[model samples]
Target: MAFTGRDKTWLRGPRAVGLLAAGAAVVLGLATGGTVTQAAPAKPKPTHTQIQLLSINDFHGNLAPNPATSSSGNVNGTPAGGAEYLATQLEMLRASAKAQGQETATVAAGDLIGASPLLSAAFHDEPTIEAMNEMGLDATSVGNHEFDEGWHELLRMQKGGCLNDGDGQNNQNSCPDPKNEFKGADFEYLSANVFYENTKKTLFRPYTVKKFKDGQKVAFIGMTLENTPNIVTKSGIAGLTFTDEVATANALVPELRKQGIESIVVLLHEGGFPSDPKAYNSCPGISGPVTEIAKNLDPAIDAVLTGHTHAAYNCSINDPANKPRLVTSASSFGKIVTEVRLSIDNATHDVDRLNTLANNKIVTQDVPKDPALTKLITKYQTLVAPIESKVIGHITTPTVVRTNDDSLESPLGNLIADAQLADTSAVTNGKTPVVAFMNPGGIRGDLASNGGAVTFGQAFTVQPFNNYLVSMDMTGTQIKALLEQQFSGLNGPEAPKFKVLQVAGITYTWNPAAAAGSKVVPGSIKIAGQPLVDSTTYRIVTNNFLSDGGDGFPAFTTATDKFFGGLDIDGFANYLTAHDPYTPVATDRISIGS
Candidate 1:
């Protein structure tokens, strides 16, 4: 097989040495046979190359550490995460691997940015890209959030430049450092499945081949979830097409093999949720889209690193040939790093799957922080302090969290929905929204109060997408269809697992045992304490994301009289201000029964 591409090079030293050694052994055997008997030369040990893959996923620009007591700060009760700690962990792991005579490559699955805190998002995630470059990231796939600003911005992230709006865009500064222009990513942003519709070309390189000093090579294929368009803002990905993950990967196997690269790994932005959520190092009853993708992958692919479910699990799933293949995920927000070791047979250049081992390591804070990362954080903090510290409002509770109850409704989600409803209802001479819905995914963090006062930074962190609020008229029938969608085809076969939308000014009952499209109990939906009339038109509000049928809510797209309002975060801020010292609302809006 011929080696091609930029990294390709002839691997002749090892084979030539082996041939010379074999000839010498044959000559000695002939001489010994003609003379006195001599002990047969000991058989040579099989040659192998060791490689260490350090991986993280769904980092989401966590430049600062989550409070030690916060859920995002720890992994199974151990304090972890923060760009400083993550950088230190990666450096230490690489050093350890080097001591063991192994070559190391650092990689990520996706979601390195977007839906980020003010520190990173304020400057269009340039800080996050710089931090990732400093941490020695080799490559990463593009997550759905990466297209939040559109594919053009994603390209800018790869090939550096300031946004055309420049500084003070979106009320936040960009490329704040006058001396340093935004230099893009040092690592490759691989997008094997995403392509340009006009030219039929991949948005980024499909795969990248890395060569080691010992003449060994490994190919990494990266891709995001195929359902990206349905989840991301439709306008952002207007000219792109996301292909099927399984077919995209399997199709590349032959091409990679043609290049004589037998050792292959895939970095996928989709992942699975384990039944044992606390089992960060083990997969107990793991099931999701990733499970099926892994099972159907070409047997030639040695391992898979996944993300997007924000789960941490180390599992060995069966490949197409029914052979176990390593699959891992390092939970979101830089909380964990996965260490994978692969031993490749030098002669065949194929991975010894039986010897492959993987483990998920917490990015613990016990070690000293990486100074470079700390400096970078300090710079951004200094620049963002004024806006971040401004008081947004006060909350009666210590924290209004996004954690959902039995019916998947959260206090924070309810508050956000009410905010959107109130904002749209305040409009004069227009259709006033009677109710609102908020997707659980949009609530990124808790509303933590310091002495009952919440800061703009906290509010921004909680609702970072900056999605516009949209008010529309939906008939009672359409509303019911929207509710039924929660239990139907949002994710995959097991879609009933809490894709529920948080609601305000409405209450309804659902039957978990009922069929998917009929999960919502008939005649149970009520608006403003009145039974829903199938023909009555009700004004509803949601972020622009859902108005365009995002998150599998096609009912929102069919609504009439659509009106776009201000940013959702601004409405949330205004609501917080108007209802100072707000109390938590009961999550009894949605109920589950027979």
Candidate 2:
């Protein structure tokens, strides 16, 4: 998600290619691995050397075009996204590589599902797994979102079958169909960072080498961020241990080299944001977790394909020796596909690092939709029409999930937080919550005020985690500690910028210049327009995400007299229904000081 406006200032430093091809006037779409941007072709080699790596990340099971195109990309005012268009783009690129005698490998950087739109989530993301199989995905890293339903369920995604239970039992009983049982994913899922503490071994294969028909091989090392536990559900990572990302990849370098795999590519599920939103293809001044990881990686590793931040960049940042190496990411939801051309050396078996080039090409909808993917999406869409089309409520203005760069709060965050507080207050359970907080990451998409009315599908897309509302009692001081937790630990000064929270029944100002844990300004926190009393007990409410200390807020776990409410989505939808023609609350709740 895009942060504050100030980010654009420093973000302008990176100058990589960011060209976009506008879609056809009536159709609105584009695709490819075939370079529209060209360089002098290499002379014919005695061996088949060039390899085409095409990838996408954070797809979130988007099988149809999103209503708003802002997240899609600035393609001269045209629509983008859909499994059909993404498949067509992949096929076109694969075909182009085949014609040129270069082997093509399609892969992803994680978040292929989870936090998905209604249609895919309605079916436990089975449609997405099927779409990936049809698109020929070879391998992928497990992003934090992959564990939304816990690791076992993630494995279930790969080893598909139908759910025998009902709601609250197995992802809404979303599996199989009237005619067939769900088949597992055909591609491979790898994770080097996530491990089972008891066995002291990785949960999934750390790396997989794709051997070509020409006897040449390229190793794909995969892993999500080291901070997976901080951001995912507690049960999702119950017994698993997350390791340092750089160390994990570095440790595998020697092992991969021993296998005679000279062409090493790291497929990571961690990324950084770029300064320019339109600079989709280039990695100029790209900043985030991936930058440090890429520069520190052993030079033996040639390229880094990253995701999870949901930002797009085709950056050629430098390695430890300061040698320029490729780093690429496609914009999420299949808006673009990153294509990297790598030329392997003849005798050394190593990739010609200097010759590698990457681009983030938009998946425009002008081409013929891949027939099979279209059929797959159509079947699910047909099955989900009733839920997808039902009206949830009306929005006076579009509700956004993007956080403020300075304050961190977002329109959608505010809406969700207020909804939670209201959802509990109406029940008249003597233990009413005085305040509510919502994590910015949980607010997935903007609830577009299309024709001034919102649909169930639109609301579902915004809050798809299916998290339940949790009310807990804590002292006023404990509440302060909870707010303070938002700044440090995972989102420290040096880490990715802090995850600004959306709040209700509370207001506070923080100073960015202050030390990490002390960032929340003193005497600035208030609840219900009254000074916060440190010693007095006050009931607080938040989604299950925060109650479990997900995203670094551990104080929530310390609350006493805890109670669980209905599904968070239901609370949000109910809030919308109760507050018809709702105008979102202003974002003055969280302020910043110099």
Which candidate wins on lDDT?
A: 1
Looking at model 2, the pairs that clash are: 4-405, 11-275, 14-284, 14-285, 15-284, 29-364, 29-365, 30-364, 160-184
Q: Which sections of candidate 1 miss by over 4 Å?
A: 1-46, 164-166, 169-171, 424-429, 491-493, 591-594
Model 1: residue 338 alpha-carbon error in angstroms? 1.4
lDDT of 1 by residue, 1-594 (tens): 232322333221110000000000000111111111112332322587878889998988889998878788898889999999999999999899989888788888989999988999888899999999899888787788899889999999999987655465454776887788998998888888887774547887777777886678888888898989999988889988888888888877787788889988888999888888898877778877887887788878888889999988876776677766778889999999998777788888887766566778999999999999999999999998887898978998999999988888899999998898889533535678888999988898889888999988889988999898888899999999899888887742467365899999899998878887888888889999899999999988899899889988999989988877888888998899999979998889999886
Model-by-model lDDT, in order?
Answer: 0.81, 0.75
lDDT of 1 at 16: 9
* RMSD, every candidate, angstroms: 9.6, 9.5
- C-alpha displacement of 574 in model 2, angstroms? 2.1
In model 1, the worst 10-residue window by lDDT is: 18-27
- Residue by residue across 1-594, what tens digits does model 2's lDDT show? 211221111001111111100000000001121112223334545553887888889898888877555655334365778889889988899889889988777778889999888888888888899899888887888888899878998988888877765632422546536677788787778777777765546666676677664567887777788878878888788888877777777777777777778887888888877777567766546787777787677867788888887777775656676666677777788888888777777678887764666667888888999999989988887878777777878987655445564587777788888898998633336888879888887877778757878887788878899887888889988988888777887767766667777889999999988988898888998999998999989888888778888888888888888788888888888888988888876788999984
Clashes by residue pair, model 1? none
